[model samples]
Target: MTTHPAPTVHDVRHEETGEGQPTTGLDAFAVCALSGAYSAVAEARRFTAAILEGWGVCAPVVSDAVLVVSELTGNALRHAAPRGPDAAESRPDLVCAAWLALAHQEAGVLCAVSDSSRAVPALAAPDLMAEEGRGLWIIDRLSESWGWTRPDHTGKTVWAQLPVPRPTR
Candidate 1:
């Protein structure tokens, strides 16, 4: 298998105030680069949980967001290909990649995964007897809203917003 760089999480907020809180009111943003390997799913979950915890999100919201990240990242790894460059490099051992981004919204956290596939995700009708195809269904049940967006020709970002309840002071 082709080796890729290990996933790294980057936080966009630069100014540090009390307890690692950003003084600027800018929305917090974090992203991780994921390889096509199945391990990326779990990696994404851990990364999301850490980021949400650092942001002081409640435990319930953090759990929901982590699950959402797992579903999105797994789907991307299974169904999408890596973006092509100017020259197509076709090799049997080559590894593809995707991206997972988390951003703080007004009342929730936005979890998005970008992959090279343009195929839109569909929420399938419940099939209790079936063993597979429940990712989107779970996401719908757990998140406030979910959808996809294609910023450019390269790929599409499948996203979900999970509502974060504010702590009582």
Candidate 2:
């Protein structure tokens, strides 16, 4: 008997966010496969910060990108997993290895994370007492626009667009 390998997640700019909008395109300047662990979120943030800085992005926007990436990656670490039972199944399909990407556009910077799961992250009312479930909420609050896309026959990519503040004349 043969078993197919679980779907993999790699955000290597399969699409492009033309006109400086990263809502529907990959067009990433940098992309990497991250281990499906919480520690990787910090590395993701650092990677984004470095890439944005190299692109001469404004500090404020870069900061937002770091935070946004953190939240997205953190959510992936906790929720995304390979297909399996919630308890005992090792879910390589859910999030064995997540992909992180950064893109520079006319607007600002786009931070994206792709996981093996096709289920998109949903926003819900925050439970003040709960310790979790606020990742997307924070992303929405900080980002100009955020959404997810399921591409081809693979997984979905969650992305956030942060618009830089224009300088006054």
lDDT of 2 by residue, 56-153 (tens): 78898888889999998887767664423452365434334688888877666777888766676778989989988777888888887888775445
Task: Give the TM-score comparing model 1 with the true structure, all chains together.
Answer: 0.75
Q: Give every collision pair in model 1.
A: none
Best by lDDT: 1
What is the C-alpha local distance difference test score of each model? 0.77, 0.73
The deviation in Å at residue 143 for candidate 1 is: 0.9
Residue clash pairs of candidate 2: 15-26, 20-106, 81-94, 81-95, 82-91, 82-92, 82-93, 82-94
lDDT of 1 at 69: 90
Model 1 / residue 152 / CA error / Å? 4.3
Once superposed on the true structure, which residue ranges of model 1 sit more than 4 Å away at CA? 1-26, 82-88, 91-96
